[model samples]
Target: MKQVIIIGAGPAGLTAAHELLSRAKDMFAVTILEESAEIGGISRTVRWHGNRMDIGGHRFFSKEDRVNRWWAQRMPPQGAPAYDDKALGRECSLTAGGPDPEKEDRVMLTRRRVSRIYYNRRFFDYPITMKPQTFRNLGLAATAKAGCSYLASCAHKLPETNLENFYINRFGRTLYGMFFEGYTEKLWGRHPRDISADWGSQRVKGLSVSAVLKDMLKKAAGKKQEADETSLIEQFQYPKFGPGQLWEEAAKEIENMGGVIRKNCSVKKVHTEQGRVTSVTVQTESGTEELRGDYFLSSMPLKDLVCGMNDVPSSVAEIAAGLPYRDFVTVGLLVKKLNLKNETKIRTLSGLVPDCWIYIQDTGVRLGRLQIFNNWSPYMVAKPADTVWIGLEYFCTEGDSFWNMTDRQCTDFATQELLRMGILTSASDVLDTHRERVKKAYPAYFDTYAQIDQLTAYLDQFENLFCIGRNGQHRYNNMDHSMMTAFLAADNLLAGKNDKAAIWNVNTEKTYQEEKNESGEGGAI
Candidate 1:
């Protein structure tokens, strides 16, 4: 039997294990080595005093039917059809312990999405809704400026070279300066001009100022707007408890299938010989041990993986080292009460709006975003009536001053920032606070991103070495995209051939198969 060693217990690695074991359980021995004690990497959920907090907000939505089906098979959707007790040859009723369908469907929950942008002490529709209230807040002067700038942009288009140019070309200079510039600079810690247009193309594709304006006009006229595209879906499925529940369930299933998962095993070295990965050396509390495997899959950061390899070309190492990542810090503040004081009136925070999260676009504050855990799911809070948990997200570079701050210092900083932004009246309103720092939360897509192509070419030479997942591939992919790559990788392993090109193209637009017209023309209908 062939032995497979998978590194990192994130979604991608776990998905690969589940797929491989399901198909070739008798022919392959699969073992997963995770550096952390937990299974989910960034998608993990943290429980504090019976409340759950997602490391980063993850919405389980994908345009791929296969991806959705894969999740459904493992964790069926709520209210999906199930075998009745009579059909299962059971005499007792469901209430009498005869197979309760609701109990069986415990993994996923359907949720509606509500997110808005909080800027200049006012809230705006996240996708830029135009309402009388929005115009009133902006005043006639700013509104005219935005409208004129958009008209000018439509008449005279600018060349889209970088992120800055992309936003200006689509939203015009005035709106871009007001909405996109500050928050983006805060998140990336660099001017938008330095960032590549690829990031903008991938994130905000199909969205344009004209489209938003049309939707707003329709809303103002009391006419129904067009349905949102897949990229702008307003509803999604989520794992109960947290995203961690999904991976934890997968880990249990893997163990049941005789696959091994080693937690707290840090990979120290990847041993390669004869242009193939022979084994991996991992360190644990006991000591170091080398495990031989017929195949290897890595979900660790590309830079660390290349550095830990036994022998690599200097050029590859240099490219890996040059890859940059943005670190993340989330300060979860537990509050006893929240009050919103606006010019019109002072009111309790409840019943104002149901927003899962709010982007902070105000230039006066350093906070990039705020997540309302309660809005995500009531279960996210220990006692929804008594306390609310809000996550203040900040982006920075590793080893930076903010990243190096102590937990107490960071929490205090968040509290003050909240007060400064008028989200909190006083620090005394906070009941408790916890802080978590995640390194390499985002892979940088700057002008230097072309170096990743070279790195990928070098890594592809190793027939048995497969790099999958976000940080593993050094791409800013969504969770579903990460799983898709893993699925393709498992297919390659099952076929006993390396198809690096296929794996690399898994999430790109070019990989999507367009529908055929009646005349057999291959184009999207």
Candidate 2:
């Protein structure tokens, strides 16, 4: 039997294990080692006051249909409450009502709806919509200034180099400063001009400032573009219980296929010999133990993974350890009452939350993104009138002052900020709050990141050892993109004749391709 040891039981690791087991049923022995006591990595959903909530926000908006098909095969049956819309895309009927009596263990559902981004201390249509909100904020003067500056900058020329220049080229310096720069700086903890433009170009490439402006103009003039049924924003699918349900289901399936998942077991050292991974030394509840493997897949932070390797040159290890990460502090608040007056479902409420996730550009406010959980799923709360769950995501790094604060202190700080913004009136209105701190949540790309080429070069030494996922590849990946990377990695490994380096570059062409499909704009209801 061919044995494979997969490290980190995240979507990537779990998917790889599943594919391997299903393809070579009787010939593979798979073991997934997860450091946390749970199966899902960052996508894990937690419960407070008998309701499920995501640490941050997790949505199902992949452009790939195969990924959708893979999920559909594992999801619960029709009566299980799935949300599918022709206009919006995909939906799951997971509710707070309770689990399915037949497949209670396999299925978890929630009725929470989704919310949009909040900006400038006011609500605007996210994805940059044309509405009363935009006009009110920009006014005639600022709007004119923005238009003139944008055209002038476009005429002047951009170097095609850094993020600041990229945004200035597209949206102009004035709008970039007001809307884009500060929020991005806060998330990455660096000045926008210093960060490479590739980050924004890759993530926000499909979105053009010209498109937004044109769409706004058309809508303002009482005109609408021909609708394309196949845009990402038109609709999306989500797990009923939260995004974590998908992974938990995958974990159960992996175990059922004679695979073992060892949770709460942290790998202390990855032992390698003769330029190959030999065994891993893990610390469990009892003590440390060594396990051997034929092939290894890691989804942990690349820096951390390289550091954990037992036999690496000190210079190489130092270079790996030097890579930085941006951490996150999520404060989940249980509100005593349903706050929104519209009461419309969250999917249609994209601009409803004012912004799906508010960007705390004003440093005076400590919260980076304020996400309304109930909007994502009504089932996030056990009782509709009982309490509503809201997540305030604060971006910080490990050992930072905010990170060092206790959960209670962090919650207090979040609540205080809400009060300061006049969003929350009294502590009494907040029934309870919980804080979750994720270390090395996102990899930071510095101006001098190219200097750390040694780490990638060292990782390249192992042919069978694949590093993937968001943290795995140190790239900003959406759920679908992350899953795609994992899928591509497995496809390459299973084929036994492909280059892993090339597989990491999957979505580069995704931008232009998507633009061709979505050419027009739509009017608001």
Candidate 3:
């Protein structure tokens, strides 16, 4: 049997390990080396005083039926116990005969997709829906100006070279300034004009004013909605605890199938012989060890992966070294209540705004987004009925001032921002707080990103090396997108196919991960 070594136990790495074992266990023996002691990389669930925090919110909504089936196989969906959501008017999907969430611990629950943009002290529908309240929120004069700007943009288009032009072309300069400009700056720590348009195209390719209009007309005409548009997804499946639950379960299944997972192991060097990867040197709690493998699947940061290699072309190495990444920090806070009221008819355990997450478009603070853990899954919180569990996400560079701050300092700063925004009535409302920082959370699309194709071509020369996941490909991929990359990679290795085009092309199309082979396997050929 050929030994396979996979780096980083994130979605991509875990999925690749699981796929190889489940597909051809006798042909491949897998060993996963993770740098951290957690199962799911950024998708991990951080528990403090009983409440759990999903580092970055993951909504299990995919257009691929195979991916949905994979998730359902792991955590079967069931009917809601006490959260009678239909009273709120939002439609949801709940299946029966899976597992009763009230009695069973490992079950999936359907959650409503309620997200709003908090700007100017008023909540606007995310993606700027064309509704009376939206127009009223923006005064008549501003609304008219926005309409005129959109018309002018449609009449004359600018070359989409940078992210600024991409947003303006799709959303008009008026809406881009009010919505996209500041948030983009806050997210990447750079002006939108300085970033590449590739990020915008992949992220919001299907979202536009015309698209929103089409959705509104379809809804008004009582037509079926398409599943490809993720922004319009009304409901999604979530594990009982958090996203980490699914990954942990996958890891267990892998072990049960004779796969090995080693935590607290860091890959320090990628040993290459001629044009192929032969082994990897890792640093562990015990000591250093060299792991020789027939195949290597890496989900680590591409910059670090390339840097750790022995021999690489100067231009390729230079581009890899200059790759930029944005770090993330989530401050979990358990509070008594929020100052915002339940303006919608949605009934909650307490009178709270029914938002799984809120985008901080005000840009007056460093806060990037707010996540209500209770809204994601009631099981995420220790007391979903009495207390509110929230997460404040901030984007920054590693070792920066904000990232360098102590946990106490960071929590204090985050609490002050909530108080400044009037989300908290007093400091006494905060019951507890915890902070977690993640490095290389988001692969940026600037700096030497333009020459990434050359870097990938050089790396592709290694016949035994396969790159997967967001950090591996240096792309902004969602959870399902990362998993699909591994699926394609596993399919290639098992079928003795050496070309990586299908794996790399997983999310290039408008509809991500929808194309499947004739065999109904989730891959693009």
Candidate 4:
């Protein structure tokens, strides 16, 4: 009998398998079942036209130094062969008197353009960068109106209980409307007030009005740019290929340690008896195989996990069904030619938009965030001038047009939007287009998220069954956080500890003190 049965091939599952076997040194058997054909879950990168493009935009920023070093050590013994850092030149060219035009294009395919918030038929500088730019966008008359609104917002700036109140307290009505309202509303398919404020608090921290004003003042003078320098807080790490490469490599490591990763093997049913997991029936190419295991670690979606369980109480099943998720559809377009503009050289578009991911605040535009894959890694796509992949991320419900649209329809829509926005000249520039619809990609944090406590209580009845991962725990965690949860779970199992709820709550702190020491440099890699 396999010692452990891991129910997903994502980073969390792979990490769990690795840590389990590595710590024990072949003390137990482990197996992973993945519904998809490949590893990495949403982090998986698909090969399109000989180029690798991610499911969406994935950045490698992490607060943990060990996570950073783990990646550095795992990547191919040698880093990607040195390309002449031409993209770096283009990034520098974004500033005045930076790189020469000929040298910049020789290094990069395109230059990064300024990203603005489009709202109420006007574009505004996001993060409220410069007072002059903000005033220009809002106009003198509107600025006065915003000032009056800001005072009213200040009077009501109590501790926020919901997402809407949080934003209203932080940025006031006008700024929040122009910058956050539409895109956020579209992302969750719910009002900002209906969603919990915890999501907002965690995602955006340390950026206050005073901080932005200070950064803008610093930029206006000849002083060093605080925006670029302090934005990331510290360094980040990425795989040579793309974000998916990390999971693929981790999968290889797990297999190397004698653990089996069964791809395209879907879990049909999870049989339980007396609140303990009994056996898991998987559907492979052959047929259904009931694999009995002493322990089960499921990284699959929480709703699907509960649905797959046999003979569960109907009330518990209904509660699991009540947990909602927001889906995402990404349209990846490969464009021909690199330099669409003459002046600036675009390397990566991290802050080009609102966040690293641009928010489409305009109601008229169908796309949400636009991620330039070439910015993450030039090697992400096949060739430079000939083919460059741009990811148009649109969030929607399962029934939304973006989700229900045919692949061809999405690709056409993306192409048309690129032309409409003047990002591309015509359809002739588009070499190839692809669209991927991800169902239940994000756990929607509604006002009723507290109801998850009831669902978690039901799962707690199971002695040997554990659910760990982003969707597994129904927590919006990043890659390292998810992997760390799995690692902690395996440790608990090995230690014969039953407290698993604590594992789900990892990465809860903002500006974690444990991740770094008093000295600003990394603690340990």
Using all chains and alpha carbons, the TM-scores for the candidates as numbered come to: 0.88, 0.85, 0.94, 0.82
Ranking of all candidate structures by their TM-score, best first: 3, 1, 2, 4
Which pairs of residues clash in candidate 4, taking residues 3 or more apart in a chain or in different chains?
109-338, 111-345, 111-346, 112-346
lDDT of 4 by residue, 1-525 (tens): 348999998878988888887777457699899998988887887788766777755545455555556555566323232224664544444434333454321121222223345455445544555556568777888788767766788777757888877777766787667666777777777888788887665555544454566666766786674322323232233454676777777788888888999988999898999878998889999888989888899999888999988887787788788788888888888877433332223233322222223445666677776666655555565653345577887778899666788889889988887677666777998888888777777876773465778778888789898888888988776676777788788888888777776786776765442211111110000
Q: What's the true lDDT of residue 222 in model 4?
A: 61
Question: What would the per-residue lDDT of candidate 3 be over residues 1-525, giving only the tens digit for each residue?
Answer: 999999999999999999999999999999999999998898777888878998878887787677788888898886553456552222111121232333467778778888788888888887679999899999999999999999988999999999999889988999999988998899889999999988877777767788889989999999987767676766778888898999999999999999999999999999999888999999999999999999999999999999999978788889999999999989999999999978776776567798988888878999988989888876777767678999998999999999999999999999999999999989999999999999988888899999999998988899989999889999888888889999988998898877888778877896532111111111000
Error of 3 at 178 (Å): 0.7
Name the 10 consecutive residues with the lowest summed lDDT in model 4. 516-525
Model 1, position 337, has a per-residue lDDT of 61
Alpha-carbon shift of residue 458 in model 2 (angstroms): 2.6
Worst 10 residues of 1 by lDDT: 516-525
lDDT of 2: 0.67
Measured by lDDT, the strongest candidate is: 3
* Best-matching candidate per TM-score: 3
TM-score (C-alpha) between model 2 and the true structure: 0.85
Model 3, CA-based lDDT: 0.84
lDDT of 1 by residue, 240-357 (tens): 5667777788889999998999999999898888878999899998999999999998999998898888778888788888888889988899997656423322222343346667
Clashing pairs in 3: none
Tell me the whole-model lDDT of each prediction, alpha carbons only: 0.76, 0.67, 0.84, 0.67
